[model samples]
Target chain A: MSLGEFDLIARHFTRPARRSPLGVGDDCALIAPAPGMQLAVSSDMLVEGRHFLSTVAPERLGHKALAVNLSDLAACGAKPLAYTLALALPRADDTFLAGLARGLHALADRHDLDLVGGDTTAGPLNLCLTIFGEVPTGAALLRSGARPGDELWVSHPLGEDEPGWLGDARLALEVFRGTPGLRVPGEAFDHLRLAMECPEPRVALGLALRGVASSAIDVSDGLLGDLQHVLRRSGPDGRPLGVVLDADALPRSPLMRAQTAALQHECLLAGGDDYELLFTAAPADHGAVRAAGQRSATGVRCIGRITAESGTTVHDRHGHRVATPWASFDHFRS
Target chain B: MSLGEFDLIARHFTRPARRSPLGVGDDCALIAPAPGMQLAVSSDMLVEGRHFLSTVAPERLGHKALAVNLSDLAACGAKPLAYTLALALPRADDTFLAGLARGLHALADRHDLDLVGGDTTAGPLNLCLTIFGEVPTGAALLRSGARPGDELWVSHPLGEDEPGWLGDARLALEVFRGTPGLRVPGEAFDHLRLAMECPEPRVALGLALRGVASSAIDVSDGLLGDLQHVLRRSGPDGRPLGVVLDADALPRSPLMRAQTAALQHECLLAGGDDYELLFTAAPADHGAVRAAGQRSATGVRCIGRITAESGTTVHDRHGHRVATPWASFDHFRS
Candidate 1:
């Protein structure tokens, strides 16, 4: 049977909120942050075709829609608390909503994040989630604290570090797009697809890095694009500093390592949607950073350092600069 | 110059948040509710062609998007605090965004509701807003507390009580669609248009009704449909109470009164987008309701009473039941 808006909400979204004072009814949901804690809130919208292909499954879409927003909280070193989802649908299909709700709830339950409230309406397919988290007052990791000599790190290795896990969702996209001269062995495709379809947000690592990381941002747009936001805002009164990225240090799967330099450079630097935590820490906190990575259960890789110079540079192992112009995803160029 | 997502945010949305610990630019915004206060949260989504018409002004769309969400907070008697906007655009156009941002900011500033944090992306046109508010513990008005002797009230009279302020946005839609035999005189068309475009959320009255109202709701869907939600959920252990709505008691504008009974019934009973506050209070609290209306600078009309019987019914002056079946707007029926 088809579901109307209210019925769909009741069936799919009306769940008990463990943390909130009230959930999923009346005019507004009620919540109270623990005293001395600040509410960390962020919102993200995912549109079909633009953010995901229609061919992608709905459950994965649900996971990803929330994942991207949670990634923001992760970038800020906040503990997941609660969220509100506002979804626009073209029609009320029960099966689609079931899968979508299941996918959303699984991740939310894993993090102990309560689904406090949201609205569902009829329109084109769109999912927007606003996640709420908590951090101690004045202790949140920000994009404005990076300084010269700060060590840049990523929560997870960008490429395949182990046989079972290959973080090549970007490459998988290229392959799906029929890019020539690309090959992946069996089951590796599944891993890559999963990485692309459902990104695991680095919330634990973020919580661990609360006091260790100086500045941070999620890699949603290309690494360079998001990193530039840190670089732009961290400047002393709008004066930007350069960053040096170690080409050899960039985590790449063995397969990616064998690709031509141009393709490898493209995937390694500008490939967006990795959803990894790219953060910076003082050089003195390297040990603490490593410990944070240990607790987070993710590899923390130091791929570069902040510099006092202008513009971003990629250096070879020999320390010679590679001449790859900066390229990051832009939502609108047309 | 066209604004990139960041540039657009910087130029338009980058305002200092007086109430929040942090505002736009961070991965997440940090808000600390006052001591003894609980956070009230709601989310709403407006897709192009669904919530609005394409020819509608961008500014109006911006205002309405946030207004509708704020109305939810008002319904719960929560004080508006902050909101996050997630916008998807086909391309980066400055004029459209400028008007949109102006409209959004104007309303945000009026309520001292900070624009906390949001995400802007490239996609089809879609806007989602998640609003945050605050209410003292145990003081929020809900939809389940009305008693059999309580009187039903609306913050504003529906029909023309005063010249130049007929809220007929839904009717304006009919006018815009060139519905035959409907003529709105002079600038009444513009007035109706504004009523539709810029809804006044009854936050003041909502705050005033915090302790006075037994139960409350915002009139978004037609009066009867939304009221049924109250009546259905307000019942003891979810048992419903019947409502006797005096048809003559419904507030109607002079123009609406001139329409045929069917059309008047359609607009008065089931017309959507009025955004007025509908509440029930103890019979003795009628004076308190009037005072709240006075403080809110809006009219308060008592149109009905709660009864021991089940289900809602429209009655004529002689106490004869009117057979107009309950109807309201539904997004999807197919």
Candidate 2:
């Protein structure tokens, strides 16, 4: 059924806010951070074709929209609280709205996040979600806290895999684009599609790493590119820090390893939309890191160490310097 | 000059946040409410063609974008704090970015609002801003608090006017659309354009009315339509509250009064984007309300009163019921 803007919001977006004093109906949503807690806010906008394929299911699009924003919170080690979604649609279709709401609310319920307030209008399809979370004062993870001696860690394996295994979202995009001579097994195809459309933000792992990890960031715009942000931000005084990422030490699934060396390198280093936490901690906290990983039920792998140098360098299994060429996804660039 | 996505953000949107612990270039921006305060949050999205004409200046577009979001905060009697802006641009034009940033920052600086965090991407031109403000615990004005016998008020006079006088934004829209037989004086055209593009949010007025006003809302939607929101929400038990708005008391300018009766009715009653505070207060608080208006340097006019009835009705100067044929602007319906 066709619905007016207000009816659409009342039917699909409005929910009783448990943590907020008010939600959905008012001009502004009221929220107060718990005593001694700070609110962590992040915003992300996704446009059709630019961020997701039009062929992607509306349910998965909803999931990914919130997933990407939650990933930002996960990077900061903040607990999900509430979010405002501003959506622009070409037309308000009943089936699309239902599936989108179902997917959005499902993930929100899992994290106890309330859909607090937002704006809806008719325009080109765009989804902008601004999320709010909370963390104890002075305890939030930041990109600039990693020191020179900290060891780099990733929360998950970083490549294509079988149906039940974690893989890269870029694989799905490549398949959708019909990349030349790229034939994937049916099971692997399913795994890659899941990776692209339904990434799981590592919120639990982020929380677990709060005290143990020196600093953290989520892997979105490729590992190397995002890692550069942390490295650049964490620079000490005038001397910038660097990393010695061992190419072989970068975790990859067996299916990914079976691919050509170039494809493997591209997927492992430059694949975007992983939503895994890449973090750093001192060598002394190795046991604590492992314990935290176990507590959160997430895998942790050390691939490098923060160094006193000023640029990132990758070394292969044979201790040979690798030629790195793939750059991370930039919205304005091809 | 060509800019990548990150460069565009760093150049145009990045600023040192005054109140926030963290700002742009982080996974999340951190903010905390002061003791005994609650955070008020609101979001608004603007799209090209639908929200504004392509001929509108980019600077004014930026101002209007943030103005609408701040109007939400004002309606809730919240003090502005900071905001996140998520923008989708068709291209990274240096001139456009500079103008947009200038206009955005000008309003932000005037309000003492920090540019906390946001997202930017390449897509159809769209702007979404999520703003944060603070109010004393339990003192926020709500749409549901207007009681029967309270007087309905508006912050400013409605309808169009000549140059140097307040006017309705809809007049500018009508002029842009080239409506038949509509001739606006050149000087009046300038004022109407300003009314449409650079709406000033009544933040000071809202702050002054915190304790005096029972309920408040901004006139983004038409007066009659938005009043219905307050009336419906303020229902006592199962019965809804209503308003007896005097059409003649709507406070039209001389230019507006010269218009045809039908045109006057449309502009004063159903024109959107006025961004004026429409509020209610008890008859006992009349003196206090006047003091608030004086304190904030805003015009406050009483145009109607709340009643125990179930729906709104309009009365002309002769005390005869008038047919209200105009509906407010609904995004999906029209």
Candidate 3:
């Protein structure tokens, strides 16, 4: 016997919130936004195996789902208010669901976001969370507001690290087969193994960029790939736009650089799953922007500039043109 | 090759909303509520083969997801404002996503809900939508405010045709056996068939019930089952509650009565998925309440009264006590 849907919701999901005038078990949760404030809303989904390893802890999965949605609101400079979670679990497990809810509530409580209303059902392991916040009108950042003269920037270091991890596959497979004493390079593990597992979402940096940055987007795709989105959107009504990247300005560890050179450096330019913020700000506001960057303890790099050239172009240290391949993830590539 | 997640979203969901200052493709969407108002938020999820038949059109699935969430806001007397959708599709089919987006947009436009930020992912079929609205503070209804003397009422009639349509165990096996020329009664078939498909969310009726109705909950589960939720919440300092139903006052069509009788008369009391509004109103507002109900054209029926007793008790036509099964799609019971 398993816990039914209604009981699961009652026991695990629908707990009364401290600040909520009306919380779970109601038709809708009611909140009074500060007068003269506008609400910001965003939704995101996390699918098992697609978004996370099946071996990942259920509690971590719940936390990530809510964390990612909250990060979206943070990117708009909105203070989180409430959220509703729609969970599709394979079956009813009281222990797993309780732990998941606990993790969700822990993060939500820290941010003052009340758990409002949502649905729970039996299905594959999928989590979709919709969150709400309030920001003063006309202040939230948008991706279409970047001007041609704006300086393109990123809140965290850009560049991918996949090829370095898969180095000498033949030798490594043979070593694992029988040679227990084979030594693996520590630098290789950091560039490859760590990068693939947990990608930190830059919540504080995104919120800090709101006032100064003219436009922004979360970097789920690679830097060059995602910037293409901002450039295309910020252009004059869907026209192509040019963005020039200073290859040297991209932050890279010594180990990463060596690994990239050995691997033809293509992976560094195109690998995905880095959940940082790519944005643009006015040249005059660069000092304040740089000051805000120090507060987050993450280096803000001026990587490029929005230009009217109508397409992306990368440059080497000598200012010569560099060829860049499509560096975004293709879900269905043979 | 199938379109990747980002491309799929760009192709089908990134349309410019007429009222949204910034729509999809943003970190977060801004919604400006009318001055001097509070915000209301609600969410719902629809999974294939569970909430609906596998054959239901994708377009209808999109509409129903938003509609159901909007109905929640309506129940709180909140006017529609904006919504964010999170959709997971098994494959990247442009036409299917387009039809689904069109359906969502059509209903949203009618209700003045601006499409805002959303995420698209590749996974099992599930659509989770969160809708936001604004209403006057202190006017939203809650389920904890019902008094013992308050009259229990429901919008529209009871008795869905799901049981008759799903057929008895014998009939279900017959259908699987390919019984040639076997026929279910047409009226029963129509009722249950309708039950198996679309459900009309009573948005307007719910909004009208606010202020007058002390407490409310949507009739997602059957009438008696949902009423138990109200009773559990409205009791004194966390005490169990009792409710008494007036059999004669339960509104149902003649066909519904026959259908229920055919299934041991439980369908009227235990059938779920009827998206009606179950509420409790003060006796003082009876006249105006009835007038409002007439205006909505959904018809309001006063069926019972909340009591301080510990458990539920139903009376038959001759006042005999009858045992009622407490199970209706119990999520814990597989």
TM-score of each: 0.94, 0.95, 0.86
| lDDT tens digits by residue: candidate 1, B166-267 | 236667778888888886775667766776788888888899998999999898877777787778767786568778898777776767766777667777
Pairs clashing within candidate 3: A2-B332, A3-B332, A4-B331, A4-B332, A5-B331, A242-A310, A270-A327
- C-alpha positional error of residue B327 in candidate 2 after TM-score superposition, expressed in Å: 2.8
DockQ of each: 0.59, 0.62, 0.56
TM-score of chain A of 3: 0.81
Inter-residue clash pairs, candidate 1: B159-B251, B159-B252, B159-B253, B160-B252, B160-B253
Question: Quick one: best DockQ, which candidate?
Answer: 2
Restricting to chain A, the TM-score for each candidate equals 0.93, 0.93, 0.81
Error of 3 at B95 (Å): 4.4
For model 2, how does the per-residue alpha-carbon lDDT over B226-306 read when each residue is reduced to its tens digit?
787888788876466878988888866666666676777787788878888999999999999999999987788899999
Candidate 2 lDDT tens digits, A59-175: 999999999999999999999999999999998887888889988999999999999999899899999999999999999999988898899999873233322122357667778
TM-score of 2: 0.95
Among all candidates shown, the one with the greatest lDDT: 2
Better of 1 and 3 by lDDT: 1
Q: Docking category for candidate 2?
A: medium
Clashing pairs in 2: none
Residue by residue across A180-274, what tens digits does model 3's lDDT show?
Answer: 44344644543343434334456667667768888877655456666766777677866756777877666554444544342323444554455
What are the C-alpha RMSDs, in order, of all predicted structures?
3.1, 2.9, 5.4
